[model samples]
Target: MRTLPTPPLCGEPATVRIELYTADSLDACAYTCTGHVIHVTAVVARAGMDAHPVGMAPDVDRPCGYVHVFPTGTLADEPAELSHPRWCDRDECQRRDQHRSRARRVDTNRPEAFIVDVALVQALHPAAEPMVRLTSVQGGAAASLVLSVGQTRVLRYRLANLLDLAGARPNGGRWT
Candidate 1:
């Protein structure tokens, strides 16, 4: 099992709505916040699917960006990840498909490839407050999202559950 920093959260629901569908700035820059270098990757996701639900037994073979925080570092440190999971292999993709009935071609750069900071997201109490500072390195407009309390709770639950399954402690940092 591994350890992680406490996530930043509002602890309660917010009174207003905060929508992050658009980017704030178009500056091509990167910044470090809370000891971590926050930046966007080449990956881009759909409107609301940037962060999807995690399975109880997540595919360990999959890249979740967890490796980035470890002593060994992130997928950027592992060249092999760029090829493995055979994103373009139609056969492999069909075999792993949950529907199992469709043999569709694999698209690696899809929404699933992006990384979501589970702990950081889970700690957010949108009902208590809206607006989160988001930083992306990839060339794109900076964006922010305002989630409803219901949406916030659902995401928090799923992410927290994943952390619990991984034996990763949450809220062990200054934000707690």
Candidate 2:
């Protein structure tokens, strides 16, 4: 039998702030429970060795976790006519396209951003810093929530600072 992350207390659900970066639309409503598996797979692949799967979806019989994804638009999926010289600078268009191509080389068919519930992730991993793998379904391109040791340091430092605040402290600790 597999172990799962303990669910949050009955009335005390936490909120995780997530930022999804993409080339186009930032529609938050696009994320749905249906894409959970694909998104989880992408996250696992991109996160590499450190991350593991957990939780369950009430509606789906298959294993599920807290990570819910919303689609962040990608330039590769955008219409070509939008980039035509009529609306924008030709030079800028070339530069944007070049950058998009480089990103495509890494993750060709997937959305640029993977929207997830960080609070649930935290509930699952507890002490461990969570990381995710963002990749295309075809394995053409990929990115990670954490890219380097330097990034880890920065993230840890920032989290620590956030935790240091009075309201952020767990269990109603006294203000310092």
Candidate 3:
């Protein structure tokens, strides 16, 4: 897993929220948070669906929603573990991973299926906080988004294409 760049401390505490979406819908099962650092948890795919509650499983009848984290600062060196089962026997999950792995190996040159881009959206007042948002790009377009940091903290961003990002590091040094 590749990490994102961290921001310098203004000596102020900030809160960030990351929302995941797929195709036309918001993936309610996925959740993210960014503050002094970024943390991505509950990444549940079909292969790993068995790990989550049946109510939280991605709707196979519909497009799947994937949880992604792109921090303005460097993320942990290792991929965060899913709270649920790590692997599933579902063909869809296997197929998705296979396709993503191949694309990463050939295109992005990363070992994983996704590459996140973290950008500095703003520097709020000492009393003000910031938020982050994540959304899926339609038609597989070049993913780009705006992160609104503050009250309401609505994240407005797109998902970049899947590519290899295993060895890549954030432009700036790691946060921790």
Candidate achieving the largest TM-score: 1
User: Deviation in angstroms for 13 in model 3?
Assistant: 60
Candidate 3 lDDT over 91-118, as tens digits, reads: 3322122211111111234444445444
- In order, candidate lDDTs are 0.29, 0.32, 0.30
User: Candidates' TM-scores?
Assistant: 0.20, 0.18, 0.16
| Clashing residue pairs for model 2 | 46-133, 47-133, 106-141, 106-142, 107-141
lDDT winner, 2 or 3: 2
Per residue, candidate 1 scores C-alpha lDDT tens digits across 31-97 of 1122222221212122221221222223223222221232222111232322222223323322232
Q: Give a tens-digit lDDT track for model 2, residues 1-176.
A: 11222222222222222222333333121122333434533543353312233343345332223323342223123333433322222344333332111122342244545432211111111243333223333344533342344565687788788877635644455332
How many angstroms is residue 121 displaced in model 2 relative to the true structure, after the best TM-score fit? 42
Which residue segments of model 1 deviate by more than 4 Å? 1-141, 170-176
Q: Model 2 Cα displacement at 33 (Å)?
A: 6.4
Q: Is candidate 1 or candidate 3 better by TM-score?
A: 1
